[model samples]
Target chain A: MEQQIVKVKNKRGVRVIPGFGLSMGITLAMLGTLVLIPLASIFISASQLSWEAFLDVVTSRQVVSGYVVSLSCAFFAALVNAVFGLMLAWVLVRYEFPGKRLMDGIIELPFALPTAVAGISLTYLYSDRGWIGALFAQAGIQIAYTRAGITIAMVFVGIPFVVRAVQPVLEKLDRQYEEAAEMLGAGRICTFFRVILPELFPALLAGFGLAFARGIGEYGSVVFIAGNIPNKTQIAPLLIMTKLEQYKYADATAIALVLLVISFLLMLFINSVQLYMQRFGRG
Target chain B: MAQKRQRTYQQDIVGDGILAVQKVREPHTEASGKGIRCGLIGICALFLFVMLVLPLAVVVINALRDGWAAYQEAVMDEYTVRALQLTLFTAVTAVAVNTVFGVFAAFLLSKFYFRGRQILAALIDIPFSISPVIAGLVFILTFGNVGWMGDFLKAHGIRIVFAVPGVVLATVFVTFPFVFRELFPVLNAQGKDEEEAAALMGAGWFTIFRKITFPHMKWALLYGVILCAARALGEFGAVSVISGHLRGKTNTLPLHVEILYNEFNTTAAFAVSSILVILAVLILIARTIVEWKKA
Candidate 1:
């Protein structure tokens, strides 16, 4: 037993900590219970219906429209957040103006604010006769109770993901690289384009993926602003809830299964990019 | 010599072409004096202010309206209070469980290298990407009376769906990654030297953990707890499906807000949502400070 322990230690490199196996077993068990088993059963329940039935449920007009709205808004919101969040993170990390720390703290407000509050607040801000909404109305721009409203709510929640993800990368990037470029007679814009952006590209992509993923799955914030109009403003998650409430378990599971595939594929794509970046290291 | 050369080079630029020159030399100057950069910062400041601060200000203003007796009545009503309690209770329990499970998982993943460990590590993040609505449905399919485990749970009279336990379960699923995400990198970076030192000092595992590991993990754990709490309180997708929206029973604050909004009680919805918004803001501020401290 002692020799076996020594062999295990040799294989591990680090000395074997006591209880590691026990903890591993417990961890796997917990993950299986809370995550894997539950997720698998979604597919299982979904599979109970015939493939034709599954297709019909998932591809229903309202459900399809919900998907269109969710994916399009999430995509647009994530793109907007990436562009603007990068700029915001750049300002926070590279500048030393008054209220900088306060500004930094405010960047995470979306993460902390409950989605319901975020949704309602956005609605309040953009609803006709409301502060910003009245101004938009004067400009003939309708936001509240429309796709624009959904996108706005999504942007409100999604910005923090990009800012938080990109901030550290920006902060840790050696200023020496950009400074060296400046010393080589490269202009500021050229230096940013050539030196700074390339290094930040992978992190920015990761942030975009995260923000997009969150937006796709988002329900709480969008529902208030969406007006929950079927075949129009309704989101995919809300559709799933509708099916469930209607006691169509198989239908709900099938719709969920479709969403699962899309979200999983998108996340997998992002993860692959992240892995490539890790392997290549800040190129 | 490099510093002197760089400064003089910047000065030479100031003498050469003002616009391009100032832009090139901007990095060496006091950050405040960077003209276009300051304008860029101003734009960023405005965006964050309008998106985050203004929405929150509206919530607070609505919450603090002293003479809005109807709104106050809505916020403090029996249904409202019960919903808030349910929300808090479920969130606290879920976060407490998540912390324990997340720490153990993080420790196992960080301290030990095993086959499939990387796979397990990646799998923890699925909940983050997985639609919460899907997550909620899975729970229903797993623990609802007709679900796989539902029969067993029903036999034992242990209700999982449409109850507080259902809310806790879904909250756990959604917030599961926070503690692990926070701690895993910290543990991996810090390594096990202090733990080893404690072990060599004749400290048992529990003693070593309590004295050594816990101190390092406390702040991360607290941050994770706050995040989990915020997620739990705000989670609408999963909780709404599982809660069945029993007015004074299973309804959480988020669900309450939804229900009130559906009822067209806009003022009440804002009032209830504002309290959660304040909690979220406080938690975010705390997380930012802790993160800044770590930096």
Candidate 2:
């Protein structure tokens, strides 16, 4: 029926697909309405503040500590996840054992599980009376409701990013370089350091960057576990939430703008690096 | 365009590289490290258990802490049911809107050529790198009281912030990229030759899409929707920011869990969480099956 309408408008030599205009128009409209506009609103609203005010909001004592806690926790999480997630990926890609499928599936638990769920569960698990917490309690080491708890939650969610990033790279890695390294009088450890590590370096960097960005933004999981004691375990994202809760719109946006810019740069850098590696890794 | 084609060529070469590696592979001293392999595998197991399994087991355990009666009481309560309804209602809505949008966007991106295409692609990807917390903040800034639309919306007496609409919008924003990302790569891989042929034969867009494009894109679309559903159901940060913590009103399951946990209603909190945890596990199963089938 629609084709019947388009048939009359069609030229003899040219074939027009129905709905191209409608589809493209709808796509662009939604893209603009849902994505571009709201994102742009951040900068536009943020611009409402004076430059000094913007600096003050982002550099306040509380905000500074938040930045410290968030950045340090995320940095630690990403650093740990990059090493351990690579190992997990290596195990999945380069080895076979019983329950391998189960292990592989479990690696994605963080991806599928709700952060709120992760938060509460991690809290319960590490709370003094909780199972894991009880163990740590015996050692006089507190895990839950601390910075360590926050880091643990960040690590939980960030690990999958690293594993997912590195798995395919490991699977497709050409073995020739390692063989050639061995032929050149290099030991296994030496060969890995010189040859295989370089190839995997880009993946590791991309994963770490992505994980760090995620950890910095992470709130749901971190909030439940973090004591949320102001300037202690409070993270930047949580600080923004607190500011928003107080109806400090400008301050919230100022902080969010900083985070937004940082995340955007990190994401952009990772994308370009990953794209380059995909194009040239094997070469 | 040339870059995308080059990436595909590289992918093919990498596939060939894998085969080449297999052909020339031989046992070496490094390959003979059975004990080390076991040790590595053991560490992986411990990591998985300590991280993934322990938390999951804890959720189940705490949910049933008071036995089946308490679990039932927690889950079947009016507020709990209401939270579930709100979560499902908005998640389904977000998924439907984004799925339609994702299809249209991916189709436009894969078929048509125009300026600013790269920008359009990058815009679709913006949500991924964005913090969920930031995502929530942006929406509130746009639609909250004293926001750009605040006056207009207030004049209309429509409440978005601290309401269901805000919750849905935030969920939509955060989960928007999943379907698009999933479908774009698949749709791009499937160029437009068949679509062009179908158009030439005088098929309507609906007919062409249903007959030709849908078959090729169905699995990818399904994959995208599943992922979108998983994310929509699990979204917390964005929804929490706008949801206002109104029990049985604005609260989704995640928010409900937060409320209960904070209230020291551990049983109820864990029970409500188990509902989502179950849903999440189901999503994981569906994803695994989808991946297995796709592979």
* Weakest 10 consecutive residues of candidate 1 chain A by summed lDDT: A10-19
Residue-level lDDT of model 2, residues A102-208, one tens digit each, is: 88888878988889999999998999999999999999999998889989999999998899889989999998777776554454455566688888988888889
Q: Which candidate is the best by lDDT?
A: 2
Off by over 4 Å in 2: A1-20, A176-186, A272-283, B1-32, B200-204
TM-score for candidate 2, please give it.
Answer: 0.89
Stretches off by above 4 angstroms in model 1 are: A1-14, A280-283, B1-27, B30-33, B64-68, B197-202, B288-295
**Residue A146 error, candidate 2, Å:** 2.3
Clashing pairs in 1: none
